[model samples]
Target: MKSTSRQLALSLAAVTLLSAAPGAQAPASSRTRTHVQTLASDKFEGRLTGSSGEKLAADYLIAELKRMGAKPLPGQADFRMPFAFTAGSKDGGTTLKTMTANGMERTHEPGTAMALSFSDSAEVSGPVVFAGYGLVVPESQNFGYDSYAGLDVKDKVVVVLRYFPEDADQKTRAILARYADLRYKAQAARQRGARGMIVITGPRSPNAGELVPMSFDTAIAGSGVVAVSVKGGAWLIEGNGRSLDEVQKELDSGNPHVAGFAVPGVTATINAKVIRQQQTGHNVVAYLPASGSVSGVSKPWVAVGAHYDHLGRGTTGGSLAGKDEVNQIHHGADDNASGTATVLAIADALARQPRKRHLLIAFWSGEELGLLGSAAFVSTPPVALDQLSAYLNFDMVGRVSDNKLTVQATGTSAMWPKLLEQANVAAGFDLVLQEDPYQPTDVGSFNTASVACLTFFTGAHQEYHKPSDTADKINYEDLDRVGTFAAAIAKRLLDGDQVPQFTKVEQKTETGGRAGLRLFTGTIPDYASDVKGLLLGGVIGGGPAEQAGLAKGDVIVEIAGQSITNIYDYTYALELLKIGQPAKVVYLRGGQKQETTLTPAARK
Candidate 1:
């Protein structure tokens, strides 16, 4: 006996909630709440990416699609798509030892007197070089202080201060704050030919007590140099009979007055290691054929999607719950379990009534980890991107309170607002439409590909990405309404005569979240670009990168003296750059290595 759509709906029905976007009367379903509860249950282990919990979540989605008679997305087998990514770095253990040329040596405990997360597992000893601040702002020649100016640290242990110029003007301080990354400091030292580094808080600097704590090992793989902070490093500088305080005072003045010099008779040994473990995540996909299917059409596909994975135990990526809760289970019921359940319900409704245009339903993983899953799919899509009509996305749709709900991608297509309004007529939701396409979701991946897209969000609450976001916290009735609303919109786009047209909008630069970046390179990194170096897709016109002659298709292999392996390396390298600084950059064009000097400007 074939299961009817009515039977599927009857299998789950028990709740109703208000939409955040105005008034809405939509279908009711107990399964909507049940799904959220089940997904966010403690048994799922928070559905962390690449973990057993994530695998279980993927399997559940696959089984659901199979039950709904949903076919594979074009060339896919079953409903699963897999991908791999580096989930940052982890610390195993570390060691630190110091020695003199005369054979005197002292060894100390690791992670106490000094510690590091992404340091190479190497034992290197070199003469100590007092490279105050260890900064190299070549662009600030007139008023900038370059701790590296006229200082040679090649094959030596260089000591540097934490943070930027302590006495910089408000404007300068704001700009320099973005470059205070510790890894960038290590990269800077290695670029200057230093074999190792020792970090010390300058006496005049605020918070000059102990080094910042490393609660857990970070997961970025690096082999740059052995670096550490020291409890006994003051003796090295004090032995030179010069005041470290005076050195810091002059350096913090934000003007050039002192040059870094060698610390006499002090040799050091550093042993630091960071363990890098690889992990895998998956995406589940299914396709629904058009009623009769239209041929000879430029765009013949419509899609709906949501990320099914959440932080396992709150990884470093999308957790805003603070460092103290790293090991806590992030149920993510509202963060995405609600969205995932909505996708299932919508797919079931679509399966009952097929369309004339192809429908690709995808459930992505790793959205919290920099949109890795969706990025991978869009990069190597089963079908060409141009063939896609429009993508409808549902994320965080489980918590719609009041009568208001936000709908994105309104600016993506001229027909979107009317289409959304028409669909909501039945559901009667007060729809709030946004125009920007640059968002932190799977919708962002499709938007960058010029695909017309719409993303639904119920807004964030205190429970987002936290263990508190359990199924009990989900508003099931609202999720079901959103599902029906989304399904109606998707069906209209599929069967309607007027195809939604794609519009190119200014991709806005995200701000206030990057924490420590003040300058902008204006280089749009191609997340899909698979190259040894960082690839540029579009350079903001008249921005620093464009003004420096950097163009699209240019693969940046080296910046200053630091090698660029990927976006992570490029980000760390960017932190070393200062506003108005001219740094050497090496790129590849059709296999030819070329170089340019980019004078970065203040981030507008």
Candidate 2:
């Protein structure tokens, strides 16, 4: 009776498959579609890191892995691995007060004055100096504009105008705008030995006399100096024998000759406290041991992974949602759910057949927040780093237009070309191979750790990082094909006699994608490091950093005489470096101080 019922069920399944519409997905593709839909649904709340939605996604992935006969990584009790990250920052009771030479004092209201999100949490009181539009263009550009030129602001507070010159020509305005960020201005003040910086929006500019909003800051620490923005501060220059309007008009001429003057007997006291909110995020790690392991044979491990976290509710940054879609769920279907589903499919396929080596499958969180999860994993791994042979990463593989797929980080291993050629015969994909391993994804973490890595991606679209990126837009057939191709690559890595060797590729500097900065230092910062100074993950081969004897695991304490306490300070210091000009660098290696001179290169 049981055999007869099974035969009847098989007949019904065959009938259902035959009655499906033309171009319907097969069983494998159907499973992929199911995974994508389940993960990208509104119930997951976009799978934001450290949120309850992320926990639900983790549970679902854990259950799926268990169903595939995959167990927790070696020496682990469960599949969950947790890491800590600074979720966000907020202001805590910031205040500003001013006193004149005549003993007249005024305390600014909260709405009139506010601290920037990156400002250091401290109290400072000093004499004030009027620095005109604190703009400093890099010397390489030859624009020759410096607001601090010939100004003595040591041990004093600086009052500068916000934004660039309003009356300058388009080309001039463009150059100034590159260095116009408030954090850059604060760094300039700190480099000049100023105790604090106060920014005031000029009356002639747009949004005149409005305090700068406390925007979201992701830095783990402060910007090294007290910085604040005020709606209006005409009284600061009242004792300087000049009205704020006249000074602003003179400085707006773009002549570059206007100089800043000292505001006599005017001292201001500023107290700013920026509190960073921290949270713990988890990465799902599971392993499939070799099919039949020999007791004495040494086996290397290979990894396949993808990031599962995405923007939540179009808030907490990294959201491209439209104004109408504000506060809506940013369904990261193509952004990551497709990649996660593809990894799951690969895990299922490889679990059925494996011969030589173990497989580590990981689902990373906090990827949108600077690859935090992967960075944490590499810093502290369950197995020895040298035992990891290769890593395959899938980022966005759901939208395969015209059968085209981009495979990045191919240069990380010399064996990739032949291996990829062999794997593509059955899948027949038009592969675009990129040599650079300095990608903006989790692959970068593994690459910096000297692991051979490859990242698979389909072309980006208008729906990326936005609320419109829904599961219904995914192409399941091509996604399944991608999974099959990746599984074939994983099989070679797992069953082959020889593993791929790691290769260090020299990264090329492009003119775009550096936030309009012109100088290139070829330094890669480890954003997950908790040290007081900026930590170097790895430097580009044959670049300025490598030539200067800087290597991985070095902490940069100062660059070109500017103190570097965090990534923000390091970025601001880049604005002061000139192409082909040598600058002093101080760093800590193995807890020992070292110094070198590095020449800056111009980005192509």
Judged by lDDT, which candidate is best? 2
| Clashes by residue pair, model 2 | none
Could you tell me the TM-score of candidate 1? 0.77
lDDT of each residue in 470-511, candidate 2, tens digit only: 888999999999999999999998888778899998888731
- TM-score, per-candidate, Cα-based: 0.77, 0.89
On TM-score, the candidate that comes out on top is 2
Query: Model 2, which residues run further than 4 Å from truth?
Result: 1-26, 109-112, 240-242, 291-299, 322-324, 510-513, 528-530
What is the Å distance of residue 43 in model 2 from its true position? Answer: 1.9
| RMSD, one per candidate, in order | 7.0, 5.9
